[model samples]
Target chain A: MTLHAIDLSVSRGGVAVLEGLNFSLSPGTALVLRGPNGSGKTTLLRTVAGLQPPLAGRVEGGGEEIAYAAHADGLKAMLSVSENLSFWASVFGTGDIVAALRAFDLEALSDRLAGTLSAGQKRRLGLARLMVTGRAIWVLDEPTVSLDAASVELFAAAVRTHLGQGGSALIATHIDLGLDTELLDVTPFRAVWRASDPDEAFL
Target chain B: MIALLTRDLRLGVRAGGGFGLGLAFFLIVTVLVPFSIGPESALLARIAPGILWLGALLACLLSLDRILALDWEDGSLDLLATAPLPMEGIVSIKALAHWITTGLPLVLVAPALGVLLNLPGPGYLWVTASLLLGTPALSVIGTFGAALTVGIKRGGLLLSLLVLPLYVPTLIFGAEVARRGAAGLEVVTPLTMLAGITFGVIALLPFASAAVLRINLR
Candidate 1:
């Protein structure tokens, strides 16, 4: 499957942020989104993920195939690591979280409550949830937050394995994961504000 | 669908998850009313049906924020929206889960609470039956209200505000059925109206809730 965004314009709180942006990611490849703060990186990713509709253009082949992972880890504090993963697994209609558990080196902490894990560990568990999603396109927003170097490598390896198996990822991150991925700089697509527009005055 | 239901049920039962909180509130309301009324059996019996219905409605309202706020805070709602499941299915399952956790308990323990209020014998079956038919609508309507104010922080107050007006018809029919059944009056009219509201909301409000949720997600 290929995820394509054509002439996509997205807004944040009713103001245009990114306009006329275009990108495509085929199977077995990855696209890394690069931009500065308040540059609509999150907005663009969300638009493609179908969390919010596009202002003008439509996203092709991205809705059902996309599994979004935002800054929030989406883990239940009370459920154990395995239980949390299993619940998402069942939700995504997949079974056998053993591979997911082993991918993130979470087998040891499988029985522990998610709340008890360290920050990095919690982020790891959150990233581990993607493995159970079984979707082709991953729409991740700063997925490496709170991760140490080794854990970043773990995440990098997981993405590599996913890409090797014909999956794609559209990640918004600052640090490079040392993966063979394409970089799409969003600075050019920044929607310029006009003096005549009333909305831009408040912005 | 069952997976979501079971997960919510498990979360509700977990410590500090607010499972029994509504039931406890209902109990307190039922128990406190008599003390204020001076233990007069006649007045208590006369008011038991209305009191129980109001108690159930408030208890359901109290827990309304829990339906989607937790998931919204943790970004589970976003992910669930992107999942293969339809938004309608997600909201329906959520309402079903809330009914099971909060509304179902209030129904079961309502009769027991009625005993404390000196409720007449016939009121037990009618109250329970009315709650059984009515609480699902409460859950579904509360789901809509919760979805409406989900984006706002501290939305519980606004949720109640948006939901209580919608609850009027259900409350009227529900309380009427209970009151008339307690008095041994014919109840087919209010009973059917209660069922109508329940079925109508159950059939339609999920779409409205789903649409509101999508807008909130936006």
Candidate 2:
């Protein structure tokens, strides 16, 4: 499968966060999205994941299924980690979460409420959700935000393993995943403002 | 689709202590009003319609903030949005959950609250009927507001401000019908208008709520 984004632009609150962006990724490939904070790295990932609508272009050539892990961790504070995984697994029509949990080193925390986990643990649990999705394209936003060196290594290993098994990923990360991934710089797409059109004024 | 609905219903039922809390608050507000107003039965009778409407309105307001906040926080909203179900269907399911937890229970409990306001017998039916017609609109409107504010910090009060103005028609006809029933007058006009408002909102709100939620999620 190949994921293609053409002429993509996204604006938030009148400010264009991403503009005129284009990218393509093939199956079993990884793209490391690099940009400074607020450079629309996450927005670009979201557009690809179909979480955020593109202000201008469209994403094409991918199947309906895409797994996304946003920066928020998006966990249920009250539900146990196992419960969260089961819920997501059911959502994706994949009833298995044991392998994902084991891959993410979250088997022990599975019985604990997600709120009780450490920040890194929570991030891993969030990533574990992607496994159950079994999606062709993995859209990840800042997936390594809270991980220590070891967990980061574990995440890189998991990504490599995912790619080794012919999966594709579009990851927006500040740090390198230590994999042979393509690099896409998103700084060119940042908003540029002019005192012209009122609607486009929030550059 | 059934799975999504059942999941949200289960989560809402288990986490909906606030619904009970809202009813308790309504009971307390009704009980305190007469005592504060010098135990004047006549005054209570005159204000009963207003009081019940206000109670229902506030109770509706009490839970609007939670309609989408918990789902957004828990990542369930993401799963829901991406599920096989359409966005409109998801919004309807959520609104139905809101009605089941808060609106339905409020209608069932309103007759007792009506008694506290010294409402006459006919007024109880009016209150119940008005609530049944009006509260779904409340949930639908509030669902739109909740979606707008889902990811924003300090959004609860803002959501109230955005949604309350939209609630006026429901409130007006609901209170008017209740008052006419209390006066032993024909309430058919106001009742029909109230039902019209409910019908209109129910027909239109799911699309608006789903659209707004998609924007917010974006």
Clashes of each: 0, 0
State in Å the error of residue B196, model 1.
0.3
Residues A1-203, candidate 1, lDDT per residue (tens digit)?
A: 99889999998877889999888999999999999999999999889888888878879998789989999898899999999999999999999899989999999999999989999999999999999999999989999999999999999999999999999999999998999889999999999875456754353
lDDT of each: 0.93, 0.82
Tens digit per residue, CA lDDT, model 2, B1-218 = 56565566666655543657667777888888888887888889999988888888888888888888887876768756765568888888788888888888888888988888789878888888888888898888889889889988768999999999999988999999989988889999999999898888888888998888887876
Worst 10 residues of 1 chain A by lDDT: A194-203
Can you tell me the DockQ of model 1?
A: 0.82
TM-score of 2: 0.87
B42-125 per-residue lDDT for model 1 (tens digits): 999999999999999999999999999999998889888988889999999999999999999999999999999999999999
Clashing pairs in 1: none
Scoring each candidate complex against the real one, what DockQ results?
Answer: 0.82, 0.37
The local lDDT score (0 to 100) that residue B215 gets in candidate 2 is 76
Cand. 1 TM to true fold? 0.97
Candidate 2's C-alpha lDDT?
0.82
Least accurate 10 contiguous residues by lDDT in model 1 chain B:
B75-84
